[model samples]
Target: MTNLLHAMLGKGLGGLEQVFLDYQPILEAWAAKRGGRCVGVVRNGGKVAAAQAGRTPPLIPMPAFTDWDPITLGAARAVVRANRPAIILSHGQRPARVFAKAAPAGVIQAVCVHKPSFDVTPGTHYLCVGQHLANLALERGAAADHVHVVQNAVRPPPVQAQPFAREDGPVKIVAAGRLHAKKGFDVLIRAVGKLRAWDVDVTCEIAGEGAERADLEALIKTLDLDPCVKLVGWTDDIAGFLATGDLFAFPSHQEGFPLTLLEAMAVGLPVVATEIDGPVEILDEGVTGRLVPDDDPDRLAEALGELISDRDTAQRLGAAARELVLTEYGPDELARRLEAALDGMLVNSKA
Candidate 1:
C-alpha cells in the first residue's frame, strides 16, 4: 500500500490547500478501500496545528521545513524512511525540487506542476494539472514521457438549481479564490467598475481571504465600487453563496487546473474567465463561458455585460457548462485514472 502526502510549497493558505482539502475525503476514502493511507502534510505545521488544536482528527501533522532547510529536508527524509512510501507526490515547484533532490533513491518522485518554474529536474516525473501545464513543462525541457496531464477533481456539491431572474440593477457575480495578486482580482474589480459605467447593473462578491484583501478593498473604494461590489470573505458554504449569483468571473493571470472553476462549472454557473493557461483547457470559450484577454478590463467587462444583457443565452451557457462537468470531470473517473497512474508507476519501479 502507498502513503500519500499532501505537501505544501509555502506556509500560507492558497489554492493547493483548497484543492487537496476539498478532495481530501474522496482521496482518503478511496485509499482506505484500497488499503492505502492518505494524509495532509504542511511545512512548519501552521495550518495543521490550527486544525489539530481545533480537534480535527483526520489531518495528520508531519515535520516539514518551510524554507527547504536542512532540518526540514532531514525530517522529510526521516518520513521516507519510516513510512517506506512507494512514491512521494509533492505539490508546487519548490517541494517538487526539494523531493527530487532529497527524497530517497527510487521513491518514484511525482511533482504536481501548476505554474511556471525553472527548478524542476529531468528525473522527477511531473503530474501536470492540465494540458496547458503539460505543454509548458515540455517547453521548459521536461521529458515528454515524464509528464502527465491530470485534470483536478472535486466532489460536486449537491445543488438544486433555483431559477434566477435578472435583477433591475447589477447582475450578481461571484469571484471565489484566495485574494492574491495572481488571482487578478484587481483586473476584475476594474472590469466591474467599467460595467457600471456602461450602466450595466452588476454586483460581484469576491470570496476567500489573503494578504491582498486590503489592497483589493482599497481599489474598490478608489473606484467607488462599495455600492456595486462586495468582498465577501472565506466561507465553507461556497456553493450556497454561489447559488445566489448569476455568474462566476475568474481573472487569474495563470493557473493549473483550478478546482474552483471546476466547482463553479459543476454548479451550472456561467463563467467569464481570462484567456490563461488553465481556463483555456476547461472552458469552451464563447460556449460554456467567455474568455477575455489576460489583463484587459474593458474586454472582460464587455464579455460580462453581453452575458448580463442576454439572460436566455447566459442560462444556456451555464447549462452547457454543467453538462461538461458531468461528462469530463466526474469524481469516480478521476479516482480511476489516479489509481491507474499510481499502479503503473509502482509496477515500473519494480521492473
Candidate 2:
C-alpha cells in the first residue's frame, strides 16, 4: 500500500487553506480504503486547528521557515523518512520547495498550485487548480507531462424550497475574500459607487479581513458609500452570509480557481466577476454569469446593473450556474480525478 504525506504552510483561512481542509477527508478515506495511511504536515498548527475545528487525519505541526533553513529542512526530512511515503503532495510554494528537497529517492513529489506563483522546485509534478495556471507552470519551465489540470471542486449548497427572490428593497450584493489589492475590493467599491450614481438602490457587503482593510475602508469613505457599502470582516459562515444576498461580485486581479467564486455559484447566486483567468474559466459569457473587463469599474457596474434590473435574467443565470457546478465540479468527481492523478504520478515514478 502506498503511504501519502500532504504538506502545506498556511497561516490563515485563504483558498489554499480551505482546499487543504476540504481535501483532507477525501484523501483520508481513499487511503483508508486502500489500506494506506495519510498524514498532514502544516505550519502554524494553531491556525489549521482553528480552521479545521478538530478534523481527522491528524496534522503534524512543523516549525515555520521563511527560506531554506537547515534545521527546518532536516526536521522535515526526518518526518519524510519516518513516514516512508510513496508520494508527498505539497501545497503552496514554500511547502513544495521544502518537501521537494526533503523527499527521499523514489518518492513522488507533486505540488498543487493554488495561485499565480510558479516558484516550484525542479522535478516536482504540478497539480494546478485551473488550466491557465497549468499553462503558466509549463511556461515557467515545468515539464508538460508533469503538469496536471485538476480544477477545484465544491459541495452543492443545500437546496432551497424556492429560488432566492429579490426583495423590493435594495439589491443585495455580497463578495468575500481577503481584503487585499489582489482581491480588488477597491474596484468593487468603485463599481458600487457607479451603480449608486445611476440611482440604483444597491447595498454591497464585503466579507473577510486582511492588510488592505484600512485602505479599503478609507476608499469607501472617500467615495461616500458609507450608507450603501460595508466591509463585513472575516465571516465563518460564508454560505449563510451568501444566502442573504441576491447577487455576487468578484473583482479580483489575480487568482488560480477561487473557491469563493465556486461557493457563490453553488449557492445559486448570479455572479459578475472580472474577466480574469480564473473567473473566465468557470463563468460562461452571458450564460452562467457576466464577465467584464478586469479593473473596469464602469463595465462591472454595467454588468451588475443588468443583473439587478432584470430579475428573470438573474434567476436564470444563478440556476444555470448552480447546475453547472453540481454536474461538473462535485466533490466526488473531483476526488476521483485527484486520485487518478496521484496514481498516475506513482506509476510514472516507478517507470
Candidate 3:
C-alpha cells in the first residue's frame, strides 16, 4: 500500500490540464485497491481545480508564481512529509520545479513531460509522451535509464454508430484545440479559402477558445470566409461536435500526443491532419486518414478535397480509424502501462 501524488499547476484546462483531471479518478482508484489514496496539488482557483469540484482524489490548492517562496516551499514540504507518498508525479514545468524543492529523501520524483524542456531535476524520472520528447530529455541531461516513453491514450466514445449515407451538401470540416498559432487555425482557414477557390464546397468550424481568437477571427474575415468558417469556442461536448463533422482536420504545426486526433478518430471521423509526429503516429498513410504537409494550406486543402470527393473511401477510412482507437488506445491499456512504469520507477528508486 502506497500513497501517490499527481501535482499539476497548469493555468487553464488545455490538453495538459485535461489529462491531469482525467487521470485523477483512475489514479485514485488505483491507490484505493492498495489501501492508499491519490492526492493532487493544483493551482488555486484554476480551471482544472474548479472542474474537479465534487470529485474524488481531493485537491490541495497551491499559490501561483511562488516556486521559491519560503512559505510556499515549506508548505509543499509539509504536505510531502504528511502524505509520505511513495511517488510524486508532477506534470508541467512549474509543478516539476516546485515539487523538486519540496520532495524529501527516499521519494520517487517523476515528471510526465509531453513537450521539450531544459529543466532536469536531479533524481527525477521522465515519462515522456513520445520518442521525440524522450530524445529531448536525453539531450537536456536526463539519465538514459530513468527516461521512459509512455504514449497518451484515449477512451472510446460512449457509443459508435457507422455514419449514415450523406446527402449532397458542403462537407463539414471540424477542427478543435486552443485557438493558438501553433494549432494553425489560420492555416486551416486559408485551406478552406483554397478549397473554395478550387470549387470544393466546404465549411469549417474550429472549437476551443484562447488568446488567438481575435487574430483567427480577423483572418477569417480578411479571407472573406464569412458564414463558411467559424470559431465555435471551447466545447464540453467534443464527441457530439465531432459527430456533426463529416471530416476532422488537425493543422497543428507541432504536437506531442495530441488528444484531438485520437478523439476525432475514435468517433469514426475521417481525418485530414498535418504530417507532424503526432498525426504520423496516430494516422496511417492512405489507410485510416490523410496526412498533409505541416502548415501548407494547399496540401491540407488537397487532402481534404480527396476525402470530400470520395465519400465511400472516406467512410472506410473512418471505420478503420475507429477500429484502431478501440484496439490500441483504450483506457485499460493506459492504466496497465502506467502500472508497469510506476512499478519500474519504484524498483529503480529503491535499488
Candidate 4:
C-alpha cells in the first residue's frame, strides 16, 4: 500500500486546522480504497493532536516545527526517512514551508492551501480549498497542472438542521466566525441598525471570538443597538446555536469557501451573505440565499429586511440552500474530489 502523511504541525484551531482534522480520516479512508494509507503529523499534545485523538491510521506527534531551525528540519527529515511515504500532504504555512525541503527523493509533496499566503514550492501540487484559491495558486507561480480544486466542506451535523420556525418575537439573525475586520461584522452591525428603519424587528447574535470583539461592542453601542445586537463569543456547538436562529447572515469581506456558511446552509437557515468569492459561488440570488454587495451596510440591511418580512420566500431559500450544501459540498463529495486530486498527483509524480 502507498504510504501518505497528512501534516499540519500548527497550534490552535481555525478553519484550516478544523478542515485538516475533519478531512484526515476521510482522506485515510479514501487512500485505503486505492491500496494506500494516510497518517497525520501534528504538534505533540496540541489542539490538533487532541482533536484527532483515537482515530484510525494513528498520528505522528512531534515538537512544534520551525522551518529554518536545524533541529526541527532534522526531525522532519528523519520522519520522512523513517516513514518513506509516497505522498506528503502538508496543511497551511508551517508544514508547507518545511515539507518542501524535508520530503526526499521519491515522495510526492502536496500542500493543502486554505488561504492565499499558503504557497507550495515549484514541483509541489496544491489542493486548494476553493476555485479562486486554485486560480491564485496558478497566478503565484505554481504549475498549471499542479493545482487542484478540492474545495472546503463540512461534515454532516449529528442532527439535521431544524426547520425555520418563529412563533413570536423578532426575527433572529445569527452569524458565526472570527470577529475580525475581514469578516465585516461591523458592517453587519451597521445593517442591524438600519433594519430598524425598515420596520423589521430583529435580534442579531454574532458568534466567535477574535481581536475585533471590543471594537464590535463599541460599534453596537454607537448604533444604539444595545437591545438587539450582541456579539456572543465563540462556541463549539455551532449547529445547536444556529438551530435557534431564524436567519443566517455572513458579511465577510473575503472567504475561500467558508465551511461555516455551508454549515449554516446544511442546517436549513435562510441566509443573507455578502457577494464575496465563496458566497457568490454557492449562493444563487433569490434561490439558495440572498447576496448583497460586499462591505456595504445599506445593501446588507436591505436584503436582511426583505427576507425578514417575507416568511415564505425565506423558507424556500433555506430549504434550497440546505440541499445545495449537502449535495455539492458535503463530506462524501469532498472525499471523492480529494481522492481524485491525490490520484492525479501520484500519476504525475510517476511521469
Model 4 spans > 4 angstroms off = 160-164
> Clash pairs of candidate 4?
none
Off by over 4 Å in 2: 159-167
Model 1 lDDT-worst window of ten: 160-169
For model 3, the local distance difference test gives 0.83
Write the residue-wise lDDT of candidate 4 on 1-351 in tens digits: 788888888777888788887778877886677687777888877887887687565678877646888877877888888877888888877887777778877778888887766654788899988888898888889998799998888767665544446577788899999988999999999998999766788899999999999999999998899999988888989998887788999999888889889999988999999898888878999999999998999999888888877888998999999888889988789888988898899889878
Query: Over the stretch 89-171, how does candidate 2's per-residue lDDT look in tens digits?
Result: 88887887788788867788888988886674567899999999998898899887788988899887764212346457788
**TM per prediction:** 0.88, 0.95, 0.95, 0.94
Question: Model 3: per-residue lDDT, tens digit, 1-351?
Answer: 889988998778888887776667777877788788888888887987787776654688877677888867877887788888888898877777777888877778888887765478667898887778888888888888788877787888975534435577787899899878889989999999999999888899989999999998899899999889989888898888888888899999889888888899999989888888777877898899999998899899888888887888999999999999888877887777677777788779777
Instruction: Write down the lDDT of every candidate, Cα atoms only.
Output: 0.75, 0.84, 0.83, 0.84
Which parts of model 3 have CA positions greater than 4 angstroms off? 159-164
Q: Which 10 successive residues of model 3 have the least lDDT summed?
A: 159-168
Q: How close to the true structure is residue 99 of candidate 1, measured as C-alpha lDDT?
A: 59
Clashing pairs in 3: 208-233
C-alpha lDDT (0 to 100) for residue 330 of candidate 3: 75
RMSD of each: 2.8, 1.8, 1.7, 1.8
